[model samples]
Target chain A: MGRLLERLDKVDRRVIYILMAASVIVPLALKLDFPIPIGSGPSMDLYMAIDTLPPGSTVIISFDYDPSTKAELQPMAVALTRHLFGHGVRVIGMAMWPQGASLGQQAMAQAADSLGAEQYEDWVNLGYTVGAGVSLLRMGSSIEAVYPQDRDGVPYDSIPLMRDVRRLGDVDLAISLSAGDPGIHSWVMMAKDTYGVPVGGGCTAVSAPEFYTYLGTGQLVGLLGGLRGAADYETILRERIPGAPGGLATPGMAAQSISHLVIMGFIVIGNVAFIAGRSKRKGGAK
Target chain B: MTMEIVGIWLGALLTLALYSFLYRDNPFYKFTEHLFVGMSAGYWVIYNIYNVLIPNLWDRLVGTGDAAPDMMMIIPAVLGLFMLARLVPKGAGLSRISLAMIVGTGAGLSLVTTFRTNCLSQVEGTIIALTGAGTGQFLSNLILVVGVVCGLVYFFFSKPHRGVIGGAANTGITVLMVAFGASFGYTVMARISLLIGQVQFLLFEWLPTIPIFRGLTG
Candidate 1:
């Protein structure tokens, strides 16, 4: 076992790094699409939530991620907005993270263009709120106190979009695509629980399980987790939009599958080595 | 094929380069890390100013006159600028004005909202119907409530105890630890999974078509 350890320890880590990188990259390049048997409960609930909304019902979405998660969460945000506006829902968007507003704008604009949804008429952006969770919590009742003006700082009263909107009760639903602190938990704690609005969310995979307890109790109507969640949300979108390019989900899933298989293989090989070395050491001692 | 293959190879190399840090700190990891940070920072600054500050703040306060005056914009606009005062040494006192506006309002907001939402409603959500239809729902909500209560108690950093309350607090600590451990495990898996995707993209997709790695495929 000591000899085995010595030998294995000498093996170059660069080789492993190289091997793992190949495991992720190749599958994505092939445009491999392997759909894991995902439960439709969450996906379907999300679809129906947006589908069932009254036409032009006011809804709010907060983009709570920065560029680090842009690769995974952005696509889901686009698809959800597309689904929301598709139902003729009037939308107002906000951001918690400073970098979030741009991505939010770009996504809403794209989804709006695709659906021929007019901005400020059907939707408007409030931009990044400086105070994070506090902004939403307070703005629920008096929207003007938090944002005296629209995104361009035009007086809130003057903007056609803000004219009739006041308080959390006016918003039919709230959704957040979150990364971490000041994200889903904040909205769940503030908007839904405090203000009595229904909430739904999407988050990175690592952040999903803590939320499952929320899901189980129905704090959040449904949730999409990590890259898998994003891909699943995209699948629902493709089915709805017919022939819409599914973006990164297809490649993302393929890359994920290949990565999993590779990691599993390494674990198997490692166990074999452990067993073999144990017997060999016993023989040497004997 | 050419463009697609090239992208795969680049992504794969970056994945490998990033993973190099796990072995030990090295130039490969540093290069990729810096590039990622730099790109993300550049993207963030541009977006913050152009999309957020410009549309949300600057354009509103000092309009180009292309748009008419928004007289009410001056208030929040000045408050927002005070936030930048935190960077100056002498003027750092001015930053407190920003901090007060942000923190005081935030605290007030959370105090009212947190009680009703996090405390009261969660307590209500804690109720469960241990019977036919909502059985699983009931059980899950029960666990969630217990977890959240014990979890919050565990985080209390004040006096340690020796009685029944102490025992409960200790148990709460255990629950939080287990939860944290599970979170860590999930994070490791997600990162490893991401790394694996990069490698697969490189080999199967990139190598098969690229001039440099085409030989490896053959």
Candidate 2:
């Protein structure tokens, strides 16, 4: 039995990998729907921030993530876009990261298409600019000065989206969907602090804790942490706006909940083995 | 085959190739890895040439539309060209000027803001009002204050960790460990979320085309 215990401790890592893969795949294949309790703090704060916006108010959503983080960040982007467009709020899209521009354009199109929102009039893609936070600082004064043209090289003046929107202050709210640096941090620093515009957005779960300080200080109105956060936002959005398309995050959350349980179970088993090994060693020493 | 089906198959093949690294690093994994890196680098080059260099640098220098050519743009243009000098080993020394300007501008801009936002704001956040009415709020505030102080003390290496100071330092270390553990747990959730996303793609998005899983999706 001791020998068997010792071997269990050294079981091949490939087996663990297989188990992890199975845990994720099975829940998804079986279409498992786990009830996730949504905390009414950050998620609620973010929802109300947009919900309270008077119709016809413009919002800038900076896509500061790329394809690598699409799975985690894109759902929130899509859902947020849908929420804003559903409520007749105009969106002005921009990107801090170069690759994020395309992703933003795709999300904007999907959201607009579903609602029959007009392009250029309802929303416009300003594409990407070179400077990280510096571009944001420039935007605090003049957006046209920072981005001379839209993504297609059409002069900013020609675009109808900018007919009323001139600078960051003219917009009611700004949210940056970020995966890393030059994202939420940059928006908070330049947009909120400098321009006095309200800032909020989603980030990877890994980055959520660091931004909690910002939330505490009210520098960020609210935030969506990860897939779970995205799921919460989608749920609330669907509830508010009937017949809303169930975005990827809802099903993603189902898989996330089950996989988390599987991981927790492994952690428990691993710790038990470690404790047993330690006790046997202590007994041998005695 | 329809373009959509071909694209899906291509994506699945590449996904499998990348996942091959889990079993063992083989030629398929290497090929996909190289293809990804090479394609990314090439894409950035092409994108910047049109999106950045042409619009911002070139258009500004040549003065498109009703605007006159701005001579001031020449200085930065030359410096940017010098940035390319690093590609040639002989001209590598010339790249230092561009690098110096970039560093100088970045450091000068960030130095004050970093101090103000990260240091001052964080300090202000830590100094929460303890006189809040609710017991729950007060206790939470108390924990926040203690955690902040102890976490800071844990980093204070100047004082000798002995006696009473040692006790406080130990508590600080414990707080730090708990914070680190929470962060690690959050990171694990983030990674598992990524895995779930990939599995979802394979199972739902890719598998639907096949006859077996068609009914499952429907």
RMSD after CA superposition, every candidate? 5.9, 1.6
TM-score for each model:
0.72, 0.97
**Backbone-clash count (model 2):** 0
Give the per-residue lDDT digits (tens) of candidate 2, residues B146-205. Answer: 878877777788999888667777888898888788788778878987887777778877
Please provide, for model 2 over A4-113, each residue's C-alpha lDDT reduced to its tens digit, 9 standing for 90 to 100. 66776888888988988888888788888877676678988999999999988999999999888888899999999999999999999989888999999999999999
Single out the weakest 10-residue window by summed lDDT for candidate 1 chain B.
B193-202
**What is the lDDT, from 0 to 100, of the residue A180 in candidate 2?**
96
Shift of residue A141 alpha carbon in model 1, Å: 3.7
Lowest lDDT block of 10, candidate 2 chain B:
B109-118
Tens digit per residue, CA lDDT, model 1, B14-126:
87798668789999999999999898789778866775566656666676556666768888777777777778888878878878887897777678766875556556766
Question: What is the lDDT of every predicted structure here?
Answer: 0.74, 0.87
